[model samples]
Structures are given as C-alpha cells and as structure tokens.
Target: MKIGLYFGTFNPIHIGHLIIANHLAEYSDLDQVWMVVTPHNPHKQKHTLLDDYQRLHMVHLATEEYGKIKPSDIEFKLPQPNYTVNTLVHLKEKFPANEFALIMGEDNINSLHKWKNYEYIIENHDVYVYPRLKSGNIDPQFVNHSKIHWVDAPVIELSSTFIRESIKNKKNIIPMLPAKVWEYVEHNLFYRK
Candidate 1:
C-alpha cells in the first residue's frame, strides 16, 4: 500500500487541511492519506496549542466522514518537538510492508531546507506537494528531482490561527470547519477567551 502521511498540528483540523488530504487520497497516486496529528511542531509556536489529545480528537471528527483520509496519533507517543525525519524512520520500521510518501504544501516545500534531516526525507520519501493560496510556483532544488511530485490540489487559504481567532472572538466558524469539528469546539469551548 502506498500511504501518504500528511503531517500537521491540526490545532483544529479545518477545511483547507481536509481538502489537501482528500486530494492526496482521491486525485494523487497515493492509496490512502493519513493526517498525522503532531503533538508539537518544532518550527511553530507551542503556547497557544490545544492539548495533543484534543487536537487528535478534532482531527478524527473532521475526517470521520472521509473514508480515504484517516487520522493518526503516532506523534503522540513520539518525543516532544517531533521531527519529520524521525517519524518517517519510525513509521517505516513499524510498517515495513507499506510504502510511505510525504504530503506537504508548496509553502512547506519552500522551507524544505530548514527541516531536520530534510535531505534524507527528500531522498527517501515520495513527496506530494499541494498548492497554498496566494503562493506562486515555488521550485526548490529537491522538487526538480524525481520521486518529489508537485500536486495540483486546490488552494484553500484557511489557517488554524484564523480558525482559533474566530472561535475566540465568538465568530461563526461553521463555514471554515467541518460540522462535527465546529460542534466539538463549541461544546468543548476550545480556543475561547
């Protein structure tokens, strides 16, 4: 099986995240796409993040209806400030029979050099890069090579920061998030003041 790992904090999985994962599952060559809900993102701020379990549950709610897009909690057991390289290595060991690919946005592709052991990641994994809204064609050196694919997934501009801010400000977030996710947020009062 060819599995595409879509890594993210998914602070609260929004439509944009879902769309990218769905594209990888249905449109790309990937057999399935798993949204790897990270406990912490090394490159990002951690102060405002929801608890890892909550974030994982939110991802589950957001993707429940999508059979092709599954939610993963593999990072929860991994060390803090999880690095993509380490997770890929661990997953490869655990699921030896399955071929794994990396799923990321074009914006992430632009910052590929900054990631931990990014060279190894590029060399070993088949990467499916989706487009980000307002982002022009970003061609990194690694993308010029084979195995790294630039996917034409639609650009959905929504961000978790915007979703959290909207929730904190008591703005309607139903349009930005899935119905189950929005309901879970409202019921749990996540990201509220």
Candidate 2:
C-alpha cells in the first residue's frame, strides 16, 4: 500500500487536520493517509500539551469514520527526540511492502534542509506538500525537486493552539473540532483552564 505519513502532535484532533488528510487520501495517489500522532518532545514546552495517549485518542476519534485515513501511535513506541529520517527508516523496516511518503505544509519545505539527514529523506521518499497561508519562500533546491509534489489542496488556517485557547477562554470551539473529538474534550474538560 502507498501511505502518506501526516505527523502532528494532534493535541486534540480538529477539523482542519481531517480536511487535509482526507484530501490527500481522496485526491492523491496515496492509498491511505496515516495521522501519525507525534509524542511530546521533552525539549519543547510540555505545559500546553495533553498526555500522549490523550492526544492519540483524540486522533482516533477524529479519524474513526474515515476509511482512507487512520490514526497511528508509531512514534510513541520509538525513542523520543527522534527525527523524521529515523522514523522513515523504522517504518521502512516494519512495513517493507508498503511505500511511504510524507505529507507536510508548504512552510515546512523552507526548513526541510535543516532536518537531520534530509538528503536521504528527499532522495528516498516522496513529499506531498499542501499550501499554508503564511508559508515563506521555499528553498530553491526543493522548488523543483522530483521527490517533492505540490498538491493543490485547501489551505486550512485553523490550529490546535487556537482551539485550546478558545476553550480555555470559554469560547465555543465546537465547530473547530470533530463531533466525537469535541465531545471527548468537553467530557474530559480539557483545555478549560
């Protein structure tokens, strides 16, 4: 199977994430889009994030109805502070028959060169980039790279941080999240500081 790995913290999976992943699964050649729930990196701020399993559960809730999109907890089992290159290598080993690609925003393309062993990733895997509202100039080298494919998907401007803060401030973030996921968050009283 051809799979596109869409990595995110998914603090609480929301509609924006579903839109992009669904788009890739339906419009692109990828057979399925895996919403790889990223584990919290000890190097980053932890106060804002929910627990790893909590986030993964939300992802599962958001994607449960989508046949082409699935939730993944692969990163949770891998070592922390892990790079994408390492994850790619690990996935290749674990699922040798499947062809794995990357799903990322246009802004990430600008910083792709800085990733560890980025050359290996670019050379081995296809990168499916969707548009972002505030993406800066992309690196000239990747502008026309064969491994990179620019997908004309919707530019979703929503964010998990915005939803979290809205909930904390007593705003209705219901429309921003999937029904089941929003219900889960409400029942658990998450982000309602």
Candidate 3:
C-alpha cells in the first residue's frame, strides 16, 4: 500500500483538513492518506490543545465516511513531543511492506530545518506539499527540489482556531466542519471555551 502520513494536532477536525486529505489521496501517488493525530507537538503551545483522545475522536468523526482517508492515533503510543522522524521510523518498522510518504504544507517546509532529523526525512521520503493561503508563493528553491511534489489543492481559509473561537462566540460553523463532527461537537460541547 502507498500511504501518505499527514501529521497534525487536529484540535478539532474541520472541512479544510478533510478537503486536503481527499485531494492528496486522489491526486498524489498515494493510495491512502492517514491523518496522524499528534498527541502532543513539541513546537506548539499546550493550553490551546484539546486532549489527545478528544482530538483523535474528532478526526475519526470527521473522516468516518471517507474510504481513502483514515484517522490515525499511532502517535498516541509513541514518545511525547513527537517528531516526524521518530514516527516515520516506527511506521517503517511496523509496516515493512508499505511505501510511505510524508505529506505537509508549504508552511511546514518553511521551518522544516528546525525539526529534529528533518534531513533524514527529506532524503528518504517523498514529500507531498500543498499550498497554504497567505504564505505567498512557495520558495523557488523548495519548488525545484527533487523530493518535493507540489499538489494543487483548494485553499480553504478556515482553521480550527477560527472555528473554535466562532463556536465560543455562538457562531455557526456548520459549513466549516464535517457534518458528523459538527453534530458531535454540538452534542458534547467540547469547545465551549
């Protein structure tokens, strides 16, 4: 199987995430796209994050109906401050028969040098990159890199932070979230701030 790993906190899974995953699965060489739900990111602030399991559940809910996209909590079992290189190593050991690629946004590539063992990732794995709104054009150097594959995905301006704040302020995010996730969030009151 050809799998692409899309790592994120997914504080709350929204339509933008789903769209990107779907587009990658369809357009890239990947047969499937797994949203590797990060339990804890060493680089991001902790207070704004939802519980790991909670975030995992929301991703599952958002991706339930999609056959090509899967929600993964593999990082939950790995070490804290999870790094992509560590997860990649674990994944390779666990699934030796599958071909895996790293999927990321241009924003990630911009600061990728800061990531632990990022060079190993760039050399060994195929990096599928999607454009991010307001990031200006991707650096020409990266655009011409041999390992990087740029995918043309629709840029949805909505973000989980924006969605959470909207919900906290009593705004409707129905269109911005997956139907099941929106219903689940409404029923459970997960992000009431």
CA lDDT of each prediction against the hidden true structure: 0.86, 0.94, 0.86
Model number with the top lDDT: 2
Please give, for residues 1-193, the per-residue lDDT of candidate 3 as tens digits: 9999998878788888999999999987899999998786666776768788888988988888999999998888987766789999999999999988988887777777778997888888889988887676565667788888988998777788998889889998899988888888899887787
Model 2 spans > 4 angstroms off:
none
lDDT of 1 by residue, 47-116 (tens): 7798888889998888889888889998777887678899999999999999899988877777778889
The per-residue C-alpha lDDT of model 2 at residue 102 equals 98
Q: What is the TM-score of each candidate against the true structure?
A: 0.92, 0.98, 0.93
Which residue pairs of candidate 3 clash?
none
Score candidate 1 by TM-score against the native. Answer: 0.92
Using lDDT as the measure, name the better of candidate 2 and candidate 3. Answer: 2
What's model 2's overall lDDT?
A: 0.94
Error of 3 at 122 (Å): 1.0
Candidate 2 lDDT, tens digit per residue, 123-151? 99999999999998888999999999999
Model 2's TM-score against the true structure: 0.98
- What residue runs in model 3 are displaced by over 4 Å at the alpha carbon? 41-45, 137-141
For model 1, where is the 10-residue window of minimal lDDT? 134-143
